[model samples]
Target: MTTLTTPTAARLAGITRTLSEWQTADWKGFLHPGDLGWNSMAGAEKSAADLRCWTADGTVVAIGMFDGEDLFRMAMDPAALDDDELARQIEADLTSGRVLPAGTVTVEARGALALRKRLRARGWNEGEPWTPLRLDLRTPVPAHPRDAALRVEEIGLDQADDWISVHWSAFKGTPPSSDDRRRLVHRWTTMATGPFAHLAHHLIGYDNTDQPVAVTTVWTAGDGRPGLIEPMGVHGAHHGNGYGTAITLAGARVLQQHSASAAVVVAENSTAGALATYLAAGFTASEPVTDLIGSVTQRHP
Candidate 1:
């Protein structure tokens, strides 16, 4: 359980780094407990040891853990092994504990196609890359988005339940049940205390009658960089309309008011149109390293 190691740990970490796929885990970037999409039953069983990673030679490569898209992050040590031989050894080490084990695996890569090609050759399926876009905060705010009828307003703290309901309804698909929605609202509301925390702040886009329809939450990373708008979406009934573009600008406006230099959005490739909408709102776009996720299930353990 103790990640504290001397020389041996260093070598294994070196190999893992050479064979690395993504680097977010290397930096301890775990998802918040209240974020949507994290499975509850899976969460209860995770512990520090689950984060404890090792090499085929029984050496520690890094320290970290993952829960689907929740609480997942890791870091590697490059000082431990020969750079040339790192990937092979580390790939073996990772598969040893079922990290990339069988079943239907979800792989997300935000940048680069070469690495994805390598992964594809190695039997891992690639997923569509979600583009990252940026909107200058100082730019003039354009007229509201024109599409389906919507009501945009600053959220009231007393409306946590409403936030949870709207987000749950908008984002419900595979994982992150209604229970996850409640916890997510709770985390965004009170439990989290950081610049990136937007629990107490958000922009709600509603239907003509003031019912919640689209939601966008704003938060800044600890590094004081541009604001981040994540998991923004509209209900199924509201898709293909200007609600997405309108609320995106609305959220960007809020972050700008808070003194953000720029606001960035990260979303699946399917969101390109939404990005275009943002451009119309005076924002620029950036191409991200796209990773295609694919998986081959082994018949037996």
Candidate 2:
């Protein structure tokens, strides 16, 4: 029997695993295991509650996770994408508030060009474009051209506050509270004991005075697979000091050490500075992906 249901926390592992298996280089920058890992490890309790799954005969064929109320990041097995019956069923559920409420919303689907075209015909418009870049790690990554003056360290429980502080400083926002950092530390620590522990790493880069000035989180899909540097940033005070490239290279090294064939990252097409940093770190750009935005409305059979 095929059914729709909200996944409980216990079922998160299965969902993330299925998503990882479906990921291919062709679907690079789409939803993947690392996205879920980052969510779970960073203690995205609220977003976790929003996860939805479509299962057929005890197997998950489709999954969706909300980045926020109006933006749903999702993917489906390629077979389901080609199955007319399942495609219609998914459309019905999404429009009837079974997946999300009625309103304007966006869905980023991997290899769903047909669905995107259909939605566009129904008054939906294309959302912003995102560029996915990758660095080949099949061979050893060359050392940075600049001297290695900065020091990078793997983040641990004791460095939770420092890590959070660096992130907030980079984004210029209200800092995460001590309680929030504690939750993140707990989640990361708990994940370390789990089956997927080998695929994740959190690193912080410190300046000469021993102040944390940059942070990054890297995730791999196991050896010889493509890895990701989902969130990498340098503190605002340290922006011009080459910390961005320094920390990004550090993240790539972590992934390479784990035997990843390549390191990948996605950023808004408009984020010129970020794109430049990755390019400087030895990454080459790949084809861009677009997000599809539409109002929740009935689609005729």
Question: Candidate 1: misplaced stretches above 4 Å?
Answer: 1-93, 112-121, 138-152, 172-200, 206-208, 235-241, 271-283, 292-301
Q: What 10-residue stretch in candidate 1 is worst by lDDT?
A: 25-34
Per-residue alpha-carbon lDDT of candidate 1 for residues 102-186, written as tens digits (9 for 90 to 100): 5554433233223234456677754565555676666665666453477777766676666666666666733356787667766
- Global lDDT of each candidate: 0.50, 0.76
Candidate 2 residue 232 Cα shift, in angstroms, is 0.6
Candidate 2 residue lDDT tens string, 184-248 = 55765655445455567889998888888899888887667778887888888777787888888
Candidate whose lDDT is highest: 2
Model 2 misplaced regions, further than 4 Å: 41-48, 78-84, 173-198, 297-301
